[model samples]
Target: MSRQTFLEPFNAKAMSYAEVARTFVPSTKFTQLAGAWNSVLVGPRGGGKTTLFKMLSVEGQEAWTGAAAEPYKQTVAYTGVYVPSDIAWGTMLESLIEAGQDETVGILFSEAAFVTHVLLSVAIGIDRHVALNPVLRLEPGAETATDEPTQADLERVIATIARLWKVQPVSLSPASLVDALRERLLNIKRDTRLRAKLKLTDTPTQEYLGIDMLESASQALQAFDAAYRRPHHRWCLLLDEFEVAPMHLQKTVLAAMRASGAQKLLLKVALAPCGPDLLYDQQGSAPPSQNNDVQQVQLWYADKTEAIEFCQQVFLSRSSIYPALAGKMPSEVFGTSAYAVVDDSEDAAQIDLFTLTGRNKKQVTEQFQALAEKDPTFQEFLRRKQIDVSRELGMQPSDRHGNTLRKIAPLVAFRNAYKGKSVGKKRGVKPFNTAYSGWESIAAISEGNPRWLIGLITRIMSNNDQVQFPVPTPQQTAGVQWNCQRYAEMLQSVANEQFGSIKTSTPIYDVLSKIGDYFHNRLVTATFVEDPPMSFVVDERVSDDVEHALRIAVNHGAIVCYQIAADVGGFPTLRGLRFRLTYLLAPVFKLPMRKSKSVSLSTILEAKPETPTSQDDPTANPAGQLIQGDLWAN
Candidate 1:
């Protein structure tokens, strides 16, 4: 399918298994489930965790059921449950009630009897209502039943359950009532089975309410599972938005499920990266050690290949679903393409389409060429449009476009065209250009942190039509500049928010500035060491600043810390955690340091002398030369 047609309804719904699987094949961590695992998958939001989980669950279900497919399938018994942490408590309560009814058998007679009695009353009431008036619906009202008791009459029957159990009045809470019901149901079982185990009497009244409730609830769910007939045999509890659950409750729920040894029951949870911290903080608990059973996995940026492939699959799936523009190039309309060209060389030909674009190069040159052909005058138009837009926006006319300006060109064009038509001075202050500008900058900076990328894109797209171009008056010009500056300021703001105060007295700023300078100076050929402690190098001019910033950054844990090696030629050179900061900072600030070591500044400043002299003084080196005729020649 063509790219343009495919993305027509992109991201409108959940993606298909094939499409998502194309983006991210299940990793070892995803596939390696030998037994029950208390796994916490963590990643930046929108980094495809949901997609991954969905794919895994579906695949697991398929494997368990031995469902027919073109290829042979594996048979396994696994139930996948997704419980968003937010509603975990209610779900747990519900599951408990279900389990209790299912597992109520011979041992716990009183608990089981209570559950049986409640079921019997409900059944008898329901049957009576059905027999008396077949079409009548059981609608509960405040008044007592005058004619036939409705299914709504079941409430009274359920409420009367307290008397049979010799218990306190049941609370109005649904969960509480469910708990109470489960407890009453379990009384018989507890009296018979648990009586001997706990050395107690086999009487419903003698059973502890809490234990009965818990045990009955567990058994009911088990029983329900055994009786149910479905192809996907196991039951799954999906927990969505898990971050909402209080930390203690999250732990409690997890602990309960773990203790149950309820095979064929799976717990799937969704939580933001911040969820863990919130859980820990609310519970006033220490962070779990690495060896702890509750494993946390963060959803981070995909390798370049994965991201590009994801983009491709998204475009393809959309195109297939939508018929219009079915055969055309997708990237042409979107200003980006997932299509890549292959060279004849074996090694080059073997490269995966996704990684080639992500790692080796971002520009789809052939696609760009095709787009250029679509609009023969596009390049010229873009240049002229940029100049006109820049003038209208009150930016200085310059031969070069800064990365920020170039990146936000589309936004500026759209905003400028929009503002040109609006006629009211009272239309409120023109939307800041930086609103869109900042997003593009962040994309370049973050290297496609999917959450941040999606967030920025969503934010800009929502305001795409609304952003206006104000006439460049003196005040408006200043406003535009202010907005531009503020866009840059966001990096610092976000950093500060995440890491706390970035004091000038600290070395972080110095290192950042130096790193910035280094990139500005050496626009190409920058490298970083990946091992701990990480360190970087650029031109010597910025070295001191970079060192200081590194120190501060390390101290604050802004980055994985590293140190520079003193010796350049030592084995395992550049030992430390190092990454090229140039990739991040170059688009923001263009530094002015010279890259060539051979070009000395002194040579450029020196003038030719009228006469030459051989200066062979004992103090002077033989290589030194002096001007003879004039001592101070200009």
Candidate 2:
């Protein structure tokens, strides 16, 4: 069958579960955001933040728990309102600016408009919850109860407004105050049209409007719930893209939500990992991360075990959706001879010879025949080498008979030809090679991101899916190279987008290029040393540009920067970062699949001034003692 027949039904490239809701496979990220808990969810763009938010919805959760539409098994009535931060913030800014006020007054007015919108959402949430209770709807006093409850709600909202601004003479008319508040907010927005635009700048000012929105939302939620009398009298308010709101808004909303003491109202917000820091209160003094106020969960894989199983489930989930993939292993559908090792399978041996030595089977066979014609002993060894006993484990001919080169023809040829510079145990250097391959390699290339892993597979499956559209044969080295390069570039594009907004000296493209170039030059001789490290240690002394670049790289997932204690020049006991390109990009650079030793900045280069330098200035030897490898200097 065509690969499309088996794979197309399972494509999850959108990385969303809006349509294929049934095919939504749950991960640890799902479990963390699934219930009534409030969180500052920190992860990359496609790290399933939006997906988790969707999965927390009544229908989305039911699809997971195998029940009727319910957000969770808890008694709370749930309402998931997806508020996209950038869009909402932009719209509010536009409306507020249209009416022309001072930039300061305009910003405060915009914030007020936004907070009002959020609180109204809470009222609407309870309204939706209340709509479900027929007994409460039909109650004799239910219609009459709305006026008193709404008036009380108006008093609290008005009080919050009164506290914020001293100017107020017009009657609020509590009977239709929500409508009045909406109109009042609209009027402020309309007033902005008479003025010029405004921009938020970094200047120390205390004109910040901090009347708590979450507390106001909570108050409304409680009042509406009581007035309508919901079955469980509980509600979950999901605030998505909460981090994009002003830092003050984020802090005040979360702080007030925690302080609201409204058990019936549950607030869950989705936030990016790197942003105007949300962990601290607005004053930056108290941290609400004390478990009582706000909880945190990062969406990332802790280890290969977690990454492998999660990716496997994702693959299986996609496959299960297709009728053609019902009983077949992913290898059968995806062309992964996962059980095939380059040194074990005959086909794999040929493929690996081409990959390792840049030789085709025909050239290897012709060379073998030419060698046999010249030497009888070599020919006899070749016969014995061809006798497969137990694949790679089986011994080849003894070294006595002119070193009968068999099994890996390419390896034997390399050893026989370059006898003096052989990369073997004889030179005290472990083999300069990596044995990792197949499905596990694919998993590692994902770098623990489910969206990336699924994307990699879906892209490969779509190979020739656009042109002739044929089922690709099992993993070929050249094919793997092409696919991995494409995937890495895809990741680079994502990194570009993530770091695009940073108006700073650290351009992401330059950062990635610098890191890639540094390691490419450094790792060439790493195999000659004993247990060489693959990672690079960048010191703070190199340049501020480098430090900022590294930070941006780590945040955007371009490279994994790990902090370590090391002797950094004069600061012998200083702590700094050690970095390696995420393993996903390993194939792109042809680096060892296994993690490597850390290369320190002290060796690579010292900061040489613009003036001429002496022989001791390290500029004379940029490679340093470790990289100078005189023994490998052919």
Candidate 3:
């Protein structure tokens, strides 16, 4: 048999038994979330929010918990149900709010409309589960729920749903009942002609439907006996992509979870760090405290160490299921260094094309030396840079450039390597190579996102329809880069082009472009400035439109934020927070990807172009300080 390539069995989509167990690496946050049972899981897209939810879902997949949260298994207690976001379905809701309806009534009406939608999703999920698994226990003794549930079972489900509205039956089947409610919910959200139907049902005892409806649905899950593990069995709602849902819905859902009255129900929601929208309630009177009603857990990587461990663990776990690689370490199968980067260099990418196109250090150095000896043009440029450096240091230019060129040949060779030979004409040329490797580079390339990281690695292993053990070979790197680059480009496009009439895009694009330009030519290059503005800060008090724009930028991963008071040297003057254009856009600009240099928004807005002060008065502030004149003397 051939050597093993550690292939990942699961993507975001399908999963088999062995694949699930082999690829699962438990995280601390997931454990805490499972133990706490009610939480808001927040992070950027591909930060493993959806994957975590998928693993934790209670769909006859017990012990689905990862290793980190072990010994404390995600209890077979909660009947965990996954609810997908329907931003498509939210349009009608948005229209209603804009129709000049009373804000208070609109909020209430929207609550009913949204709650009904959640309930319907849950019912259909449960219905399908029981329908497919006929031998599974649904309730008391009925384990025979086939593709078609018995009318008696249907009656029970109907009664359970009736308890949700707290009213008489609607005489609809499980499918019909869901279809009926979905139609009305849509009507309430968008149909101006049916605008009168926005209010709570008059037949339901004049009761206004709220999250209690979801609570009732949670309680109803117990009817499927498989959902029950022991007494005090719990039910959880895994709310994914909570950020994209309307702002009010995010607040409303959290508040609803607080008032759910289903003490056993857990709230597992995913969120993004868009500050203002999450800072306060609808009344704007109070901010939601993290420790109080709902626990907030972030899934973003804090550092390279953690990111590498995660990536390594994932590789090992996925490899374990491969028959040929059953008990091998990741390093044994795939060497730790897939990337060829300079060690301890401030700029790793300063290497030559020979080093870039798939050559190890020894081979790259030999090639560079051969080129330097053969090519007069290569020698000339090296000598020119040498003379410049020699003059700067006031040193004699006898052999400094000559010595420098050979010692760090790759660094200088890149600018003129083409003069020596047609690189690919030599037969068997290697593809691109990066300067760094291991988890940090992988994490950097992934922009600290797990989904793309996982997908990229999976694609690498699956190259040539063979298990790509030892290494993915240079051919697979392009495919891997393509996916990462695609995600990065998507974020920029959203920030730039404003897909889907999202208004927040342009402001973010404008601010980032403005910041990028100023930094490249001004702040970073200015020699006399101390504590130069590194990133722009946005005050919380900014207009709602600006806040909305910033929220979109952050939520969509176009910008990464540093919370005021939380970060060292945080925005002292700005009441809100600061943001930097996400380094994920580094590839698009062909610039070295580095963390943003922070500057305050106030600084950017208030800045006046400096007028040069001549040597006549070198002490004058370039800002043109105002002179204080004595008014009494005048």
Estimated TM-score for each candidate: 0.37, 0.63, 0.62
Model number with the top TM-score: 2
Question: Where does candidate 3 stray beyond 4 Å?
Answer: 1-22, 63-72, 75-77, 97-109, 121-161, 166-193, 196-211, 214-231, 257-262, 281-285, 319-433, 436-440, 458-481, 495-550, 562-583, 591-634
Per-residue CA lDDT of candidate 1, range 534-556, in tens?
A: 12322223333343344334322
Better of 2 and 3 by TM-score: 2
| Candidate that scores best on lDDT | 3
The best-first sequence of candidates by lDDT reads: 3, 2, 1
Counted clashes in each candidate structure: 68, 12, 11
Clashes of 2: 12
For candidate 3, the 10 contiguous residues with the lowest summed lDDT are 625-634
Minimal lDDT window, size 10, model 1:
525-534
| Candidate 1 residue 506 C-alpha distance from true site, Å | 11
How do the residues 1-634 of candidate 2 rate in per-residue lDDT, one tens digit apiece?
Answer: 3555433423233444455465566666566665555555666555666666656654344445455323333533465654434444445554544544345555665676566566545434333433343222234444544433344444455444433432242553222334544554556555444333443333413332444565555555554445443435555666666655765456556665555434655667765544443445355555444356645666655444566678777778666765555655544544332212212222332233233222443444454454344434344545654632122221223332212223334333322232223222122333322222345556666666766666566555554443221234433233445655765565455432221232335455555555554444333322222223445566555564455444455555566533311111011111244556776666565444443345555444432222112112222223433332321122
**Segments of candidate 1 deviating more than 4 angstroms:** 1-38, 50-81, 85-218, 229-233, 241-245, 253-262, 271-297, 319-634
Full-model lDDT for every candidate: 0.33, 0.47, 0.49
Candidate 2: where are CA atoms >4 Å away? 1-20, 62-80, 87-103, 130-193, 197-211, 228-232, 257-262, 277-281, 290-292, 331-437, 464-502, 536-538, 561-579, 600-634
